[model samples]
Target chain A: MRPAEADGGARPVKEVRAFIASRGRAPASLLDRYVAGFGLVMGAAVVGRPIASLLGGLAGATDPSRAGAGTALVLLACAGYLALARAAGPVSVSGGDASWLLLSPLDRRGVLARPARLLLAVAVAAGLLLGLGLAAVLGAPDHLVWRLLAALVVGVSATLGGMALAVLAQASASWQSWVTAGVAVLVVLALVAASGQARPALSAAAHAPPAVLGAAAGAAALACGLLVRRALAALGRIPARALLAASTRAGHVATAAVRLDPGALTWIAEDNHWRARRLRSRRWPSLPGPLALAWQDWLRLARRPGRLALVAGAAALPAVLAQAGAVSATAALGMVGVLAGALAAASSGTAGARRDGDNPSLARLTGVGRGPALAARALLPALLAAAWAAAAFAGLALTGTLPATSWLWGPAVAPALAAGALRMARRGPVDHSMPIIDTPGGAIPTGPLFWALTGLDVALIGCLPAVAALLGGRMGDGSLMAAQALAGVAVLAAYVLRARRAR
Target chain B: MYESIITVTGLTVELGGNPVLTGTRLAVAAGEIVAVVGPNGSGKSTLLRCLAGLQPAGEGTIEVFGAAPSDEGPFWRRVALLADEPAWYPGLTAREHLELMSAVHTGPSRLTVEDALDVFDLRSRADAPPLNLSTGQRQRLALAATLLRPSDLLLLDEPERGLDAAFRERLAGLLDAYAAEGGTVVMATHDPLLAAHGRQVSPATGGVPA
Candidate 1:
């Protein structure tokens, strides 16, 4: 038995923490506390006006046509929040603490107390935002303050309960299934709301009296309290192995964030996912040399059918936003969103290109010319981007935002998206040596700004015709569509030829 | 009579203003196996990299295949270099990686995918991703991928790393077979047994044949 067990038990958590603190950095000074307080005050001052304006806007009845889509978006956001919480361990420590303190025979509850508090703070903050969104979606017809308070209570309760479920899921297999079921139910509810089937019920709840709202709020708070208590009690029961794995993942994420290298995070996530999976080797098809090298990306995509479905499902988000009156095809924000989504879909298949850009050892072993290899690799990304954009455009047509023929623009713009994805993958690390430009707004570091804009510039230039058509409300312009197709193909072909010349 | 595959005269290299190799001379013929053996930080790997055209020599002349070495696809097509543990293509099994190697090089591979798996002792773990394999198994997979592809010259850095003693002996036999097929090899190694299988040379002695 361990020495701590040999004794009566582990020391009090407070005393252990105190002992550790003594050997660590000096305590925060008065000036440090003052700066922290000032920063918080400044942040609140900056954010307070928009929040108040939003709440003021929520005081009246909402548009009935937008209610369904708004409700669906709110539900989807909650589901996404819960899923992200589960994926993130919802309970993880820093690298130093996990390595030095987690494995020791100390009080496990004490060891995890800090992360638990952090999770709680994050959940609370997210719950507040969710509450505001919910209030906005289901506007108050009477007693606006009381209705808003009830919404806040319900939102906080739901998030706290979901977070508790995630925590329990990490410690036990059965709870994990429950959390999965909960997310699925939320998604189904979102679909039901989006379909307008729940319109009557949503309308009734939006105008409900203060007494009814207060009772519901009280019940939600009681349930949230119970789940929070249970989660707190179960904190010490979490397995060390699970904790270690989660902590290591968090460490990688922290490192990536600190270094401002978002590229590393994708590899970290990919390596971790494959490390746990069991794969069956299949015979490689007899293809040309460069095509053979590119086949790995197709195989990778095929292996993750769930991710494929998720990407397909995400294609409807633009239409959903349009339906909710949040954005329009003619708006800059909406166009940017559609283009960015297509680019992201395309980038999902460019992992092979990214891997080669990061490390050329495997590429060298393959012995394929860079230009041919890149051209071959672009095919999958183009297909993915085309399919995703087509689906999105079809959704927009259904929403009456664009003509039915707009779907043809998807394939027209796919080559440009593929080129952008490939360029983004090969952009390498953020060069911190670039000059920082000062503007009236703020000082912008050109390195990260340039890194962010590298692929986007190419994509924007290639898609200029489509962008112009959309912004000018000329969706039926056949000439612009043909121009988009020509521009995309020309850009991709030029990029490939340039790569050949560069070699 | 043998054709000269590589030649270096009075090659000097410095890193961070420190001399690692100075006035090194070496000559290698086709179908020959030459092992660069030396202690740590003695420029063994540097010489191998220089030969593979990956590292630039600070001064002096170096030639491979009767031309200055270049890092390009055509150069790599004729020369295969296995230095560090390569970043494995994500989501690919060890066996599939070997299959990919065979598919990319239209020329006949030295070993079929199945034969490479068996020869490298990775047959049992063929379906496992390289990330899932132990250090030794991953190293074996790397070696298998390197050897399965067709190349005129093989540059291996620390081929014995993470391999069992038994596997190291097997690696020696594999290298010999590769040479027998008229492929040239220049390797950096610390394993005496592996080095003994070739013409051992040390960078410390200005790359004179030992």
Candidate 2:
């Protein structure tokens, strides 16, 4: 046995004692100990017969095979949540205080261990509660309790595995947070949906034969969780909070040190990595220096996963939906791209305002006049639009709905509305919310311009086919009209300037 | 005493329908780096912002150049701002950023983006994305970019904040040089050293140079 595993696999007391003996650690704080006890007791008793019956009869409800399906579902849920966390862990945890925690006396492993355990226990308890509810509601038969028990156990593995994916992603800064959860759900759901469709017997979740089915799910979950755990360990010490000293890098002159701005940290995260990755000896009959700038944008586009996904969805959806004889994939994709950006832009624009932080002078800077700078400043939402566009297209294609003749008009209309949205974003003492969370009456601060963007987008759709016809892009029907209208918008945007605070 | 180059008339600001900065008139002139001394919520930053064109004045006139803000179209090209908090595009490199800025200008008279990079000792980091640069480096970059602007008027809010003595002294020298070259500078700081170097002080809401 491994020496670390030698102590009875560590009962609560033995674990604490070993830690204290070796490193002079204290027991859990009074609040923590009490919370721990509360959790353990809560788990052990809820699984006790009487409570389980009252809660979900889940413990008493299932046949073994049926229990297996539920076990898979629970694992699926855990995995979903974990992936959500890893993808979008806040860049600034509480605006940068968490980074400071690294310097405290707490060792990283020891510090993370309790929280991870607590999370694990919580996952199991949640699964148990869910299972019990199902049993109570469905009047599950007696043989199913063992299945339920196994399902809960399996859930622990699923939760850890999913969470591990997220943690790894976040630590590596590999992807945007919003997409992380969506991707995880889509993956798990695709599996469950596909399998459930093919074999109805597998989804007879209330029926049960034995605990083996649940146990298999549990094993799969456990393996995935273990993988995530190992990945986190391999990521090494990030020391995210350790401020980069100017000395390590040139141009960090003695004259410019300030409290580490979170913005700077983000810049450092990209800048340092990029520099390290730069080719020491780049040789080429390179493209003209002036045009070379586009390569940077190309690289940026390639790196952004959500953007690619959105593009694929928008492009594919019409074809997919047409095959299924559904709604117009073109209209659907257009709306998706516009609305998502419309919603996301408000929040991002507000964030921009907040970061701008009362510095009205930035408006006065001549650099703000550049088309590209304006574009970059408003990029967060533009990409949101792009993602929406891509997804809409892909969904249409998948559903077989694309109008065969209207294909070429897709790229033209997407960017036309996008350019309009970009224009509106710039023209703000950016009208947004004081409490900018998404809620009733808490959506985008509504006004004239909001309606204008909406109207403009709709108008673009109305004219698409005409514009396509003018360009001779091809269209079988007048329905290609919307592309014509979107094409027309490009002209309006070129002539009309977006308003900003007067200098 | 520093003369007033930026002037605000009947300026008012509100947050969540509550007044944060009232119809407060203020002015700052060329060669003035005023340390806006204040306790935390005293509107020091808000005042700087009115001049910066960040937060809108609920009801007032802010003249940046010889014209009111409503005519600020040309005024923006000449202004450089370093917010109390840094602002950057996460995806763009430092060099790309300069390129973007240069695109807005009608071909600046001097200070190619490369020269500014060399001045700030940022040549090595020129290709580094803004997000990857250290705080000090980013701040220097922001300053260098701000300095490169052709606007005779310079407005820097809390520019010296969070800097060690070495960096702080270097900033003072840069300011002195800018003033010698006939540029207008309006820098806000809380540091006593910055105040002393500027030969003036302003209350959090007060605007007299000294």
Candidate 3:
């Protein structure tokens, strides 16, 4: 700890603190121009022409199916918004922002207000756009001017309502989370039960006069103002730990969405559940390391009722469809084949595969290098997928939809799908460091590796059809087996190439 | 009967475009313990990582058992590394993590999950997930995981990190026992107690003489 050395070490940290003190951020000029350009583009090519066409089409057409479909879309969007708010908390600051900005001696209100205002604006804009899109689809443009105004009013109201819920969740996490979840679940049930009925609340807003709609909009705005005011006040008292946790949760949610693994969402939600519960036990049943690891992964996945239910629900879909006479047993099996592969690929039960790259030490220590490591992780997901495929195919066989040979495909395809998934999980989010690619319009914040991985993942899905075609077509076993061997080799080659790049 | 297990010749490693290890050379033999000692940011951990094959050598070469370090042959199967920041799954308990290591590692160790939990004094919180574990507890669990896997060569970065004085002494005892069983160890450490037990290799000064 020489004085000069200490000073040298401290210099970068000092510079960073000074930079934060200045509150200097990137120029917003480009963002402003981009927003304006978007508005102009929408006005010319999207909003104007679509509205006119919708109106003309509605006037000529007799069926009101479009309106019903529009209503469903709006309801689905509302459900999605509520779901996001419930899961990801309202306000978030990165680890740096939490330390440098939130915990700093700056005016907390002023600092929080900036992002709050941006979020409010974005929410309102998204709501308005969605409403307009719905309105055009519904072809409810009899009083075109007033109808659009009404749609805007409804948008403002719904957006504000969602924001108020989000803010409340941020302010009081435990209570707000539970309450919001209950309300959301109830709303979903009610909507599902009365799905076919024309929604009265939505109908009134669509047909309401400008003055009445404006009054409703004004009331919603007032509610939002009150909520925002209270939320900002609460922010001052909110723990730094809570904010950090929220930020981490938001990051997980964002990453999970990108990865398209609903199971990852379960990981976040269940983590919160575990933290909240803090259940402890000491009962020990010793097993070998590898068996124990697999057992643990299975327990982690199955213990979360929500996740298990979701997976089981996915598995049950084809059976439900067949029972409902929506499709024949044969069609159900075909549908199940594709969906099962997808669900298998998407499942995060395979912890070894997903976490192997992130923890090279574990792999090195355990002597489970890439291929063996991936196989170990993929075992559970493959079994689960195979089980689901088997059940679905059995139904088809019982209904006399296929020969007994169809059962063989499940064992073969599930493992292949699992391998593909293991390949995808081999690269974690850490491997995808955020690198901004500069474009003429703006900078795109994404890793080049992410784009490459995404392309490869999609291409992997494309290879599934070859297997399917072989199974369903009149190809002989020798030729079909040869084709399968070639495909397997090709996949193995790709996996090896990916591993080399990773190194 | 002494045979070199790890040999690094003119090794150079750059992390984030900054050279961490430059023209560093070292060798460690079977059943021997070597300490890679250095001040902070002096490439002790980097050298260990290179030896364990977790890091790619920017220049020169690294050989473990007379084979390229990067090669995933039988040599790698006999090697184990405990990294600086030990990784544990968020959903897994400390005990479960050990169980997982037990399942994945098929080398030679006869360490049981209960034995590890008892040794680390993690019995109380064995069922608690990583989110609940303290920094010291996490480090202990990581060491416990390493024990679950039997290896001929062990590379540990800051083995005594986040441990108490008593635990450091215990760790020394454990390493001594491991060495008595004919295992080779290379630890990146600042602890004099741990360092004294090994042939000190200071890579900052271009490595120690074999």
Q: What is the lDDT of residue A237 in candidate 2?
A: 46
True contacts kept of each: 0.77, 0.24, 0.44
Order of the predicted models by lDDT, top scorer first: 1, 3, 2
- On residues A73-183, what C-alpha lDDT tens digit does candidate 2 reach at each position? 433444445553442331112222233333443344443454355545655655555445334433345555565565545545554554555445545545335336646
Q: Give the Å error, residue A91, model 1.
A: 0.9
Interface DockQ per candidate: 0.86, 0.16, 0.37
Model 1: per-residue Cα lDDT over A1-503, one tens digit each: 76556653445556777888899898999967877887788789889988988888987899776888998998998999999989898788889888888898777887898899999988898888888888988999889999999999989888988899889888877789888898999999999999889989999889899999999999999988998888888889989888888898899999998887999999999998898899999999999999999999999999989899999899999898888888776776796688789999999999999998899899999999889999999999999989999888889899998899988989989999999899999887999999989764346788988888878887888889988888898878999999999999998988877876553
Interface RMSD score of each model:
0.5, 7.2, 3.7
User: By DockQ thresholds, what CAPRI class is model 2?
Assistant: incorrect
Best by lDDT: 1
Considering every candidate listed, which one attains the maximal DockQ?
A: 1
Error of 3 at B39 (Å): 3.7
Q: Candidate 3 falls in which docking quality class?
A: acceptable
Taking all chains together, each candidate's TM-score versus the true structure is 0.95, 0.53, 0.72
lDDT of 1 by residue, B47-122 (tens): 9889888889999899999998987889889999999999999999999999999999989998899898888888
Minimum summed lDDT over a 10-residue window in model 3 chain B is located at B101-110
